[model samples]
Target chain A: MEEEAKAKPRNPSGPRLCCVCNTRRAALKRPKTLDQICRECFYEVFEEEIHQVIVENQLFSPGERIAIGASGGKGEHGLLSINLYFCSVEDSTVLAYVLSTLNRRHHYGLDLFLLSVDEGITGYRDDSLETVKRNEIQYGLPLKVVSYKDLYGWTMDEIVKMIGLKNNCTFCGVFRRQALDRGAAMLKVDKVATGHNADDIAETVLLNILRGDIARLGRCTAITTGEDGPIPRCKPFKHLFSKCISRFCSGVHQGFGKNKVVSSLTIRNCGLQKPRAILDIIKSGEDFRISTSTKMPEQGTCERCGYISSQAIDRATKVIIPGWKWCKACVLLEGLNKGLPKMGIGRSRGLNNDRKDAKGNDNAAKSIESKQCGTLDF
Target chain B: MQLTLEFGGGLELLCDSVKIHKVSVEPQNGAEMLTMKDLLTWVRTNLIKERPEMFMKGDTVRPGVLVLVNDCDWELSGQLNTTLEDKDVVVFISTLHGG
Candidate 1:
């Protein structure tokens, strides 16, 4: 009864003002600092924060062409209660919009292109691609889409039909990694920027550590990765929380499968209690030191497709097979093409037993995929 | 109270793909005023047709769900304890979904 009596009216003078502007009603509580601020101030700080990250990290060089890995995963159709809110598309959608906006507003002198990978999921990719198309026109940026069917002679729909939904994400995830790179190569862009936020990175840090993937664990926390490869990738949102990102950027409506739910649950729950914990986890991951004698996989080009691969070579036989020296994407494609859908599904160590290797790796990739969303793969 | 409820960021999928709902909610047990905690119970029972876990965890929204009242964040106004007035617009957007 005491608390009920204290409930103030809608426009009571008790409501706090924006901490930054000291005028408008504070609309959001900042996750990192717990700063309650108005919408206008939030946008200002959010964009400026990202811009600062870009400048501080030198994510780009002026006049260089950068490809935004836009998956139409941002504000597709959601509007804030006030008219100031932009319509939603999805995460990568917001990545594209925000990057382009920052580029222009800051005069970064960058030629931005929206690069999308069409995994051939009819109902899913088609709809999101439409959002990306809208972003193409809306942002005045050229769009390039590379499809699995074109590159690998298979659509995800066909792949799922062949392999079923069980290990489907593995095939999709492996193929998607290559698809984005190939798409960026096609665009001839200098770099690829993904929409991986702080939460995503933190989730990845946990996933990699749990999986004991020392290689990815070492590199996952970097703001930019694969600098030595053909295309480098940067995450301007490496510091921003998904909560804040989704609030302003909006999110895509997709299947909330059980795997995604379970994987995100731990970090998501932790995030609710302490927003800074996400960044701290990433920091811990970065500070993690793997012993040099651990025999890390040496990076090498897949002898078969020339894509970057860390797969060990088959010394006994020079032949490149499902369990041989080929990129994961190519190996999965070989499995599909060879009518042995199990090939490259798991560990590539056993050359004599493809089926057993496939079964083991299938579960492995499935667990990895469960933690990943959309085109983001470790 | 006549409140407008909007769901986005894939939260709409749980509620039959309908993004917005306008409903009348009265405080239960003849209480004089309504609070967000009460509205959430009502919305969970009435609006969310599937996967209630995606929308709510325990009593408040799932950790990733952002709640805004009249274009202001619920956290600023006191979260679940925030009092709701007539014609208030409460929006729930899930950042958990999507890439």
Candidate 2:
């Protein structure tokens, strides 16, 4: 050990002090600002930044009923859910201890509910929901679970078995968006708050650009979306970084662990530089200006379900397609019920036939001219 | 030197779901002190049973994996260059699991 010490080069700099407090030893370096801060100071700055975002954006009104979308894991996403809820409340003292005392405090005036989607992927979702259920009791929030099996009569496990893994995400993604809306509508909440952090928004911006989805690209960076829909949605964590969310989640989970309530909050990072790049993408998305002459798709209600959609409705099948005016859900259901799972999937002969007629008859065909199977809107 | 390593955020899945391991490690190539860089190699070799890529990439931990030394972020201690002491508690939490 002495010989090892001799061979090792001494660190040029000793322990540095926190940049914010200027006293305590620095614990971590902030990626956004590159500030070296201690744990206590980091907590303060992190929570304060979130509070500022909420106040500046007016994310919620005092009496509005809000539904928090939660998925059980390491609790990072759940931490965002709880943090946003707590931040909206007027108690600064309780913020630090919110996780432990959330069940007992009811003075926030806002009705908050935990909404989770069960994809019915067997072991994966089932195990995660256990953590969600535990969090429900721990936080004393009412839990509402909406499953794919109930909403669409198809579990992901069954869907994967039939569709294989190739485009399973497409089915799951489309189903989940509708399921969340249905769940929120069932709860009768005034608004829905999802834990979509900065990184997530950035990724969507990049994806929208890659797919040349100018409409979604413009709306993806907005803090609140679908305000005109039945249930308006907002992302309170839209400005917060994923790393901070993970740290906060772990901190809260550890704090509550002594009381024997395990926190199963799981977080996935998409790499370090990726988030910075994502922010740049969001900036680019914000600065984008679509030419006025661009023929944008007209927003219309799904003829069958009355949900707002931008896709053309199919006249014959009553499904949403290029020449049709039905939503993807209605079309997929029609396909499934009629034993034609491949009906709207890829570039099938049926779709080609529809396109031929669409080109001849309608101008809306241009909107979906390049649309492929599984690439339709959620 | 003897050390305690803890894994969280589904990283334990790579190691048979074992969250913690106590093991002894020595500096490689006749070095006197063990830095986090060496410790990572040791972990990849002995601890990670499969999918080593999940834990490491190009001689360092894959981005998004948080490393803490003695309850502090490894960034404070120079990351891979932070030298280890006896009985130091190191934590490896992967933030790569689905939220």
Best by DockQ: 1
Residue A241 displacement (Å), model 2: 1.5
Which lDDT tens digits does candidate 1 get at residues A295-354? 665666787788763334433223443345666666678779988787655443433243
For candidate 2, lDDT tens digit of each residue in A262-296? 11111223336544654666678788988887655
DockQ, prediction 2: 0.38
TM-scores for all candidates?
Answer: 0.85, 0.79
Would candidate 1 be rated incorrect, acceptable, medium or high by CAPRI criteria? acceptable
Q: Show the lowest summed lDDT stretch of 10 residues, model 2 chain A.
A: A256-265
What lDDT does candidate 1 reach at residue A249? 63
TM-score of candidate 1 against the unseen true structure = 0.85
CA deviation > 4 Å runs, candidate 2: A1-14, A71-108, A254-276, A309-324, A347-378
Candidate 1 differs from the real structure by a C-alpha RMSD in angstroms, to one decimal, of 7.4
lDDT of each: 0.71, 0.61
lDDT (10s digit) by residue, model 1, range B2-94: 888888767787888888898999998999889999999999999999878778888989887888787777877788888888777788877
